[model samples]
Target: MADKCHMCLLGLIILCPLLTGMNGAETTHVFCSSGENVHLPCNIALSGCTSTTWNYNRHSSAVEMVSGGKKKNDIERHERLSLGSDCSLNIKNTKEDYGSYSCIQYVNGQQQGTDAHVHLHVLHGQCFCKSHV
Candidate 1:
């Protein structure tokens, strides 16, 4: 009985930090559009990220990104800018592609954060330059 109790306690001790995720980096939604271009931003909670992945499932492949700087890799090879702690994704213009987006991060060694999901809503309109009357 004592051996079993000790084993259980040991298991908990080994798994506590991994589950708690000590000061891990985080990915949050900045702003995203439907018909227009969408931008996704991410902020690092901690500076212990050896590496990470910026995931947009709708896109063909996942982006292997390194922490400590800005990221600007769009879905369709856009030449815009993604900026720091801000991983933006532009969907161009589409109604069928209006859905959710995620930027899953594999921090430290274990899969810690994967819950940042952005929803898309398509719109139709035209904006022309206008001067004050």
Candidate 2:
């Protein structure tokens, strides 16, 4: 009976948003078979939050994708990765697009919350190669 209840709870967790609204977690992960999808979690005080932005630094062959937005000044990285307002780092499928990522959140023109960390790991191709051996 306990195991059944635990499973029910897990189901609820995955289905609650579908039944209710588009709610998101304070933290999330993005798994990639060939690439990585990064979700940078951030928050600011409700009283002072006006605008929010994301900043990330990527060095794949020692390159910059995003330095900083118009509001802030920072170094830029390579073009292999893309970023969005939700703080989503969308990287194109590339073997070299794997490394440490620094995620920053800005609110009301002030840095707040924390600097999130994300790491990308590249894996071998399909396991079919092993089967042939």
Candidate with maximal TM-score: 2
Q: How do the residues 61-80 of candidate 1 rate in per-residue lDDT, one tens digit apiece? A: 44433232334444344344
TM-score, model 2 to reference: 0.43
Please provide, for model 2 over 12-96, each residue's C-alpha lDDT reduced to its tens digit, 9 standing for 90 to 100.
4465335432232222222233443333333332332233344433554433334343233233234545555554555555455
Which ten residues in a row are the worst by lDDT in model 2? 124-133
Error of 2 at 95 (Å): 1.1
For model 1, the stretches where C-alpha displacement exceeds 4 angstroms are 1-37, 41-52, 59-75, 81-83, 86-97, 126-133
Shift of residue 20 alpha carbon in model 1, Å: 25
